[model samples]
Target: MNVKSINILMIDDDAINLKLTEVMLKKHANVNEIIKASNGLDALGVLDKRGDIDLILLDIVMPVMNGLEFLSNVYSKNSNFNIPIVVLTTDETVKKEAMSRGANGFIAKPIAEQALIQEISKLIDLG
Candidate 1:
């Protein structure tokens, strides 16, 4: 996959986590843009407004709406929601459920730069 640009939507309630992940992506990946959302509902709104988002990095637990709910909403509302989503979480238990729900990948929290890059690479070209 030879993508000309890559836009990522990172959904996490924790501001620190979001910032850390964004910094890591900027340093290690060939990302062009990074959009942020505090929760699933916010993410939905972002998705509605932006068609350029190529991928989503999601957190499982949140206040307004969690990652699993976000997956359900996206898949249920739009059958053609083809954007690949990678769930980022500290909990290992949700792996099976998240994958079943429609997540393309899963990365344990305190995200390792190399692992995050590899997971994103599998879903979409970082370039």
Candidate 2:
């Protein structure tokens, strides 16, 4: 797939996670723009912005609001809610709950670059 056609929205409170993810993805993924959110609440604010985000990489635990709370708000919103969400977390229990709450899948962090790439590739039609 062409690396300029796909866009990803990544949300994490940790600066390192965000930076690592972008760097890992930049080489192969067609990244239009990466919107960074410090917490789940901040992530929600980006939905209104016009951009080419296809999938969301969401973190489970954060300071302002957690991933679950963010998912709940997302599903409840009237906006286009069909965007695929992959939960990235350090907690196994939280991953299970996130899947139950309508997450497409869960990826544990500190994310392995190869596995994360494969997972995201499967979720999005990257052509």
Candidate 3:
């Protein structure tokens, strides 16, 4: 498949995870840009300012606002909002809840590069 570079909004409270994810994406995916947000609230702000976000990688646990809360807010604000959101978390228990809340996909944390890419490809036309 033909690869298309995309802009990703990554929302995680951990600085280390953000950096590591960025590095992994840069190395493995055709990423045009990677926007980082430390929390869901900040991610919302980023979304407000940018319209080109192709995908969202969100953590379940965060300060200010959690991934589930963010999903609620985003879907509540605009039912037609189409950006694909993939919930990234270590807690597998929240998988069903997150998916029901509007998450298009779910990935267990310590995100594998291949899995991440596959999930993105499934939600987006990367070819």
Candidate 4:
């Protein structure tokens, strides 16, 4: 996939995870830009400010709004923003639930760089 122009939004409460993912994605995906948010509310703010995001990597547990609630809000919102979201979590048990709630893909935490690249590439290419 030609991911050179893809802008990604990463929502996670852990600063280390966000930084690590950003670095890994930069190296592996050659992504255009990555916007980081500590929580879903902050993610929405970033979205409002920058509407060109192509994909979202979201965490399930967060302070303000969890990933599920964020997904609900995004779909329910009046805007026609149809960006694909990939749920990033440590709990593999929620994989089915996350997909059912609108996640385009799922990735367990302590993310493997290659796996993340492959998964994201598929989604971006398909979209």
- lDDT of candidates 1 onward, in order: 0.93, 0.82, 0.92, 0.86
> Which ten residues in a row are the worst by lDDT in model 3?
21-30
Worst 10 residues of 1 by lDDT: 23-32
The reply for model 1, stretches above 4 Å from the true place, is 1-3
List the candidates' TM-scores in order: 0.94, 0.90, 0.95, 0.90
lDDT of prediction 3:
0.92
Model 3 alpha-carbon drift over 4 Å, by segment: none
Residue pairs clashing, model 2: 3-30
Sorting all predicted structures by lDDT, with the top scorer first, yields: 1, 3, 4, 2
- Model 1 over residues 1-127: C-alpha lDDT tens digits? 6655789999999999999999999874368899999999999999999999989999999998999999999999899999999999999999999999999999999999999989988888555
Top-scoring candidate (lDDT): 1
| Model 2, global lDDT | 0.82
lDDT of 1 at 52: 95
- Displacement of residue 32 (Cα, Å) in model 2 is 2.1
Q: Please give, for residues 60-107, the per-residue lDDT of candidate 4 as tens digits.
A: 999999998888888777356679899999999888988887889999
lDDT of 2 at 3: 41
Worst 10 residues of 4 by lDDT: 73-82
On the 0 to 100 scale, the lDDT of residue 43 in model 4 is 88
Give the clashing residue pairs of candidate 4, or none. none
Residues 2-24, candidate 2: write the lDDT tens digits.
Answer: 44366778889889999998998
